[model samples]
Target chain A: MQYENPKIPEGINVTKVHPLKTFAILVSGLLVMLLVGAWLLGFGGGYLASKIPYSQEQRIADSYEGDAGLEQTELLRYLQALADKLSQQMNLEDGMDITIHYVDEGVDNAFATIGGHIFLYRGLLEKLPHENALAMLVAHEIAHVKHRDPIVSIGRGAAISVGMKLLLGDASPSLLGNAGLLTQMRFGRDMETKADQAGLVAVNTIYGGVTGALALFEILDGIEDNGLVKSPEFLSTHPASENRLDELREIANRNGWSMDNTPVPFPEFFNRSLLLR
Target chain B: MIFQILLILVLLILGYFVGSHLEKKHYQSIIKREEMLRDIPAVASKILPPGSENFNQVLVMGNVTISVDYFKRFLAALHNFFGGRVTSYESLLDRARREAILRMKEEAAVLKATLVLNIKYETASIYKGGGKAIGSVEVLAYGTAMIPKASIDAV
Candidate 1:
């Protein structure tokens, strides 16, 4: 009797399908599901979040004590005063508080947060060419507060994260909670565009021209070209300065607001106060 | 968020290309070795061949440990989610089993055995990086080899 182990054919136990075929199908399907789910959740969340009353949102924001002991400095008072005047020009509704927080650090960034709090850094402030441009900057942040973008962004993040956790487990960090909400509020592109328009309109009303508004974008673009604000987080939030400049011109043309004016110079104490602690 | 997504993309692409290349190379080597060692037959039967009294018996064994690439592991995880045949792991186990058997057969050939019988396989999983990081699968093959007893020299 002959005993032999004949050569078995290949692909007997293993599937002959190319690994990438299955991978492509699986990965693409997952991406589509994630994208669709994220979009729906983001829309639903933004809508629901926007529905939240300003007063209640303020209560939620008050839960954080990050600024509990921060005192009002000369810079803070000036920014607050600028923000208040810009808020009036923007026709902010009654009881809509726009608070300004001035940070002495030279990090080139200015952003709004929940409860109408806007934080401005000295690095970005020092670059402002005039008071009108400052009004434009403050108006932009005030516009964010007026639109309640911070809470909406938080709501969008929370909803998406909940969905992701259910589908993909804990693969990503949850974008909810106080620290994430405060430090990492990423407003949508449309939010920035709308805020830009609102800000341009308000500055035009206050300064009788969009001259300083254009200067604000020029200074921001110069900073970008100088490679000063290299943080991806900061870059990702604000719209491109060139695009904003074109849009500002277009907005001026359509609204018949003057594109050129003698821009109001900064206050006598502006340069000195920005350098103070 | 963008950075995280980019990182996952980079890992997936690297895993796929490198993993497929290595797997193909391994299969080629396994097939070539299997063909070379086919002269020594290893069977899973318990009964000894007739005239075994004129033969020597010895234990022949082989062991192999193999790991799945990150791409295959990720695919398997996806399979776990959808509940289907884990095709990615099939190739990994197949390679390990064949390699183990081939090593056992090579040992049998070295012992100058005519046949190997009662062959059995043991399989286990080992985690290398951590308790949760599944690292590799180990396959051990063992058998009894029958060699010529040199009875003709007894005269």
Candidate 2:
């Protein structure tokens, strides 16, 4: 009997598919799966979150409220007064209240958080050319509050986290880790455009026109062009083809809201107070 | 966050270059040594030949441990999510088994064995707590070497 160790022909046990080709296919497939999953789950999460009682959400928001004892300074009071006016124009539901907080930072950003808390940075506030633009800014955040976008985003974020944890087998399942789920305020593009249109409505109601309001988008666009604002991650912002200014004008035209009127200047000392410190 | 992304990119590039180079070199060496040592026949048979009384049986074994690179590990993790054949580990196991067999044949050659019989393989995967930890495998090849009694006496 003959006994020999023949070289087992190559490619029998191993796959011939190139490793890089496999990598590309697998990576692209994963990305597409994740995007689709996020979209479907985001809407599902937002729907379930919307069903939650507004009072329960407010309580949840209050539990995480350690805003370092925000002082009721003149600027804060003025901003809050403006937010109140915007809230009235926006016709938020009863028991829903808007609160404005002035962040003494140079970042050109503004955002709304849970429990109707809107943070306005000095850098952004100082850049506004007129009262209508400032109102537009304030109203945009208040519109987010009115739409309960903060809670929707929180719900979406939590749903995505739960999905990931199920996949990853999270070792630690602590309650506190999810206690403050409102840490992120990433609203979807639809929410943002809805808020923009609602904010324009408020500005149109308050000033009888949207003369200075479009400047807000102009200033924001300029800041974006300068790459000053690093947008939050995982936010699928609107596509570039839908220019906000043009869209806003279209909304204004559709609603018959005047697009031009004498712009209202900022209150005396508003600039000085913004420039202070 | 940017720093973390940059770190992962750097690790992937390093893993690809180093891992590919090492695998190529290891296969080349294994091929060269396999040809040189093929003269000592190894088989998976339990029975001896017709004139079997003149030989001494010696137990010979060879084992190898191979680690996975970051690139392959990441690929395998992706495969785990998608539920498909984990092709990334195919080359690894293949290399390990062949290398182990070559080492066993080399041992048989050292004993001037005419043939090795009843060869078998034992395989193990080394895992550490499962959270993004690098993976490794160990393969052991063992057989009985049939060395002529005359050669044993000469030794």
Candidate 3:
């Protein structure tokens, strides 16, 4: 029998490989790289986010261009004056100006944003029984700004987004461009608890007691019990009202602060008819 | 986080095993078919055998498309990061080419062709949707199949 093999065709390069071995090598290499990339992004991004400057945070917040509803109204002026009075008790960073905006909507929500902008909805404002409770509410939101919670949240979100794009190729532009929507903003549980304690201190300093803070909790507890608020503990961005009240009571008792002081009357410009169903 | 990594590793391993088995089976089938079509010679020249003026010539073609598994795709993506030869994709293209040629030879054999002449091949990458990454490769093999005059006359 003739024992000559056919010559391989010209211009064709062939590489013989053990299929299973090659597959194993490829899979292991990919897994290792992915794991290392995720780890680097997690720790590296967190460190980098904390070092962003206040000016950069303000720029990011300005990019949102939120609705300027009722910016020059008398009620808005009253609210801003009250917020300014409460903010005096907070230790704000330099160049950080807190601007209060009043939204004449029927939604029951208040939120603090990156550029020291606090949005107060008419629905929540109308429910306040007195001016002290309103001051407590404003103090809580101011505390969020004082702690730079919004900037921190935005930094973490941006870091994760950039990391994902780097790892998974280019993401859709629409998803990347959607940086607005204050309702979608979230802060960690620890930040919320810190805001609560700091807000209690601010209210105590302004009203000479914790009566407004406790009354604020009582109002929230009543609203929560009426099933008007559906935010469960896990789904809520804020801590549970009951737990926050207990913590407020503990802090007030430990500091020998009275919780039974009379709440001041609402200002003349504050319209109470909006609360009527 | 550890669980996420473990899950990804498990998926990769599964893809590797399944893809390896499929490739091995396909290779075995290709070898068997190559042996069966060996006697029908294929050449890259238009010249016919001497004294075969009465032979009939017709074009025969075969096309094949092969895709890589998820493991190989992940490997190639990693290779892209480092800018190296993507060896994982090479095998996929090679298989497509060989399979196309073999299928062309099988088509020529069906016509009782003594030989296939002026064989040519073309290849193109097929992408899924609008993404940048290649999903598969299509290889087309074409040749002129020649039937001997005497065999046709006898039939």
Candidate 4:
């Protein structure tokens, strides 16, 4: 087969491009590249992040040395037993172990990081009235661990920071260092919703009911209404307590799970605030 | 997130329109001056035109530095990724070159010179903020101005 070159038309000024047309084409092309790059980074990064190994996640989690905490006490033992009970009910993957940490901080918060490490603040622990509500909180954090959310979050954070640096040419050390926290705080609503659902399921399996999940959210909702916590729901990493309660109700209704189980009393050691410290 | 993206887009559009407007105005001024100085030719030649040897030669020079606007810098960064002709920067250098030549002509005019010969342009990049960003480009246009001794004598 012969390939023939096309002949150019005579008197055609092909080199001259309309300025407006050129501007439009260039700008649109740039916008397309930016949008496509963003989409690819978001979706591709999320997909890759979800597949990171549990061992590597543990390494990442180990790097974060949290503040000193009280050694193994009765409350710590009871909390550990409760976490073990919830762990038995969860659909956890192999090689994943839940290690509960008792921090002496007065902050009202409980968080699960990259590994199976769960940090329960004394302030949040002091607020719990029953074992079931505490179980719900523990199960929720475990759900985050089972889903490898911390690792995925870190991955997405690093991806976004790198993308920003490439696009903006401003890669300050502080920006890179705070990438994990930024992504964690902006945890997609879908992830929060998923954790809530999984947590309810785990709670139901362990206690044969879902009241603990509802009760936990109701307490949080009450605390929020009192303005004891200054952080607004809009800025929080987790969904609002009321929204989570609604979602828990929907899940319970869908599963036909009971929401009126007997409340398990808190352990005797939990009653003493000094012992908690 | 949407607001941030919108802000960037607004900045790019503003840069394009404003930068293009400034460039067009400069081009207009340059064309007008070029027309006015048509008779007083500037060339990169060693020999002068076939005129009687009755002219004074003096060194004349003009230096100009112009900064790239935000939009052009943004465009250049984008071009860096795709590896193509950076048209925005092309126009920027073009404006600088013409402005430098025009200034050199003005200098010759001040010296009562009718023609400038052996015109040369030296360009350099000036970086700022610890070499983080390109601050501006300096273009130095120099030439030997030939003052027809008659024009000086008249003066």
Candidate 5:
């Protein structure tokens, strides 16, 4: 038996390869590369794109040059004077004229364009539960103008804009269909945050503190429970809502601004507009 | 009474459609391509070959501006709706940009330069209304209207 077993050569051992481990390593490496690539692309694109200069002052001056289609109606004149007064108090650059138009539709949206063009959506106008809130929104948008946020936004959006145009063409509704909605989702959230901060500063300079800003946020928060498509627009654009509110409170505290201690002239604006209507 | 309520609803719906239609019509008339292009400077006319200007550097400015009243603004707020084609706004911006470029081109022409370098742009928001919707979007587009500096003499 010994002799028979004799020449049993020592068995050569082969370790079994674990397929899962190999796959995990490969997948992990791939994920790491993807993260690195995305970071590189986003920041790299931003830097390179920013270097392609775009001017803000020139655009504003040009915008004001054309026919500003509003007749000097009493209302128009009043609004213009009010805006000018505010601008002067705020020390906005000279040669910038503020224009106002009245729309009958309903929606809450306000925006500022280059060259001192401000649009107040009918819906937004109607929702001014308080005048200060309205002032806040206006101040915020104005701040954006002051800080040249629009120009910067345009620049930041340029890359995405090109890609979007290539993919979705002009933001035309018919061409947009469902796809355009998806494209809208692709906007950078960070830009909105920057606008919020800048807008706060602008409003603070004008209104004395973050009260107006907070009021706007409060209004937005109150409306969030409402089921509307655009209700989330502000929130979605400006993220970390709680944090922003806290920051606003801090800003108010530092600036000696009141948070709900006194009477703001809401009725005056409301009653005045009512009489005009 | 039921019939009356239904009738009121129908009228409201109809009014909405009619109002939207009227708005669209107003925008169409106000944002005429011809008028917008007219804003372009003569300098642009000289440098931009007829067709080239149409596709590029052609600007349009709107003839009308509207503001969403406070009540309307509240409605917009519920929907968070802010802007539209604002075709008029777009046209105005487009024209302004073209005009600026034209001016720059004219300057270049005087300098006998073909290319205008170092283009820049800017925008500002003017607020109106006690507390309501936006009035208009004033857009400005400015870019260096380039031609070789030597080409300036040809003009």
Candidate 6:
């Protein structure tokens, strides 16, 4: 009850005095810290984050290392050949390298890792009915590489990476968790869309390139509608935007690339390859 | 009364120290997300030739912040000199990291990079040990916001 005495009229205003005043002061300080902290963490972090370099080749190499499997090596070779042909057609610089890996397992998936690495799932390769579609796929990925889309995506990642390193002092193991993977995936999606546009343009420069984009979309649409596999990594990596696909078609049409009757025969190479075996 | 006052002061000091110590965790998660971003490839922006205006809108995510309410609970226990749940901090930490990432992308948009890649974060203590008397917690986040060289050059 003696503490209550301080609140009485005769007593000095303790609430206006030391301890309570200290509390108010502390609270004010906390608010200022929050405001400043938000700015530093948000805009300041973003500003500084844009400066880091996001290398394409290095990221592809790291992805390969992270999931190094024997099956992917062959796929990588096949993709490399495709990239070379597309490069030649697009008149890409001679020094540009395209590497492709074919994984053995049948998962309808393909991912164009930044740099020149293209991973094609066995299931996805099995599904393609024409070389045009395959060309479209490769062309799109190459576009990402040419346009430096991967580098931009990775730069965003680099900003986050630098931030984490500073906070954890290079020792925290939390980077191995699902949260880590999602952050990478989220940023990767933007690059996928950019690559699609770029890929279309590169292919369209040649006569039959536009068909590739359309055919690829048709294949993807069927897969999504059927709900065959639960979560295909390719679909997960590059989210299919209906609007985006329509835009691609519109772009192709605008360029006078039409759906002509000259059907691209399914390559006999598909039958010759013992991929299912 | 004197002993009680001494006891209360001691408890408050202890609580302040513990609260600040626990605050370090949220900071750690924010940093971890940055590291993950760095591991990925980053590309430069390549704006479509006709539509360059979209490139001007930059979306910046503020520093990943755990809820003040969540942090308030942690601090409350400090005032009471009683420890509560530690796992309660995880969600807040996660929320902050996610927000930071989203903000990074927005910033990239404004910067006109096709991909904002290779990001990392640095954390600083907003309030350290000396501020124990008036229990407060604060952390500063900073990271690189990268856009592809191609896109940046294109613009």
Give the interface RMSD of each candidate.
1.3, 1.5, 5.8, 15.7, 39.8, 24.3
Output per-candidate TM-scores for chain A, rounded to 2 decimals. 0.87, 0.83, 0.77, 0.78, 0.60, 0.64
- Which ranking of candidates, highest TM-score first? 2, 1, 4, 3, 6, 5
Candidate 6 local accuracy as lDDT? 0.54
Q: Please, what are the lDDT tens digits per residue for candidate 2 over residues A107-195? A: 88888877787878889988999999999998988888888888888888778777767765772464225344534567777888898
- Please provide, for model 4 over A31-130, each residue's C-alpha lDDT reduced to its tens digit, 9 standing for 90 to 100: 8987888767876776797888887767656654453354667877888888888887896888798888887777778887767888888777778778
Task: For candidate 2, give the lDDT of residue A237.
Answer: 68
Question: Which parts of model 3 have CA positions greater than 4 angstroms off?
Answer: A1-50, A59-66, A172-184, A222-235, A272-277, B1-155
TM-score of chain B of 3: 0.88
DockQ of 6: 0.01
TM-score, A chain, model 1: 0.87
Highest-scoring model, DockQ: 2
lDDT of 1 by residue, B1-155 (tens): 79988987888888889988998999999999988887788889998777878888899999999988888888988888667788899999999999998889889887788788999999998985675685789999999988776732543
How many residue pairs clash (N, CA or C atoms closer than 3 angstroms) in each of the candidate models, in the order given? 0, 0, 0, 0, 64, 74
Using DockQ, rank the candidates from best to worst.
Answer: 2, 1, 3, 4, 6, 5
RMSD of 5: 32.9
**Of the candidates numbered 3 and 6, which has the greater DockQ value?**
3
- The TM-score of predicted model 2 comes to 0.77
Candidate 2 per-residue lDDT, tens place, B31-146, comes to 89988987788889899987778988999999999999988988888889888889989999999999999889889999999899999999998986886667899999999999
lDDT of 5 by residue, A153-255 (tens): 4444444445545543564334323333213323246655655666566556666655556877776665554646543445566564565677777867887
In model 6, how large is the Cα lDDT of residue B84?
29
Where model 4 places Cα greater than 4 Å from the true spot, the runs are A1-70, A91-95, A154-188, A223-236, A273-276, B1-78, B82-95, B107-155
Higher-scoring candidate on TM-score, 1 or 5 = 1
What TM-score fits each model? 0.72, 0.77, 0.55, 0.64, 0.43, 0.47
TM-score of decoy 5: 0.43
What's the TM for chain B in candidate 2? 0.94
Q: In model 6, where do residues sit more than 4 Å from their true spots?
A: A1-79, A168-190, A207-209, A227-239, A274-276, B1-155
lDDT of 6 by residue, A1-277 (tens): 0011111132121122333343455557666765665445544544453343445345434655435354544345455666787877766545556666666667877755554566667788788877677878778767665655544554445555556577547834563333343235333566677777777776666645466557788888887777856575466756664656787878767877766534455455553463545
Per-residue CA lDDT of model 1 for A155-245, tens digit only, reads 8888888887887678456465677877769998789999999999899888899998889999988888889555554457677788778
The C-alpha local distance difference test score for the whole of candidate 5 amounts to: 0.48
Candidate 3 lDDT at B117 equals 83
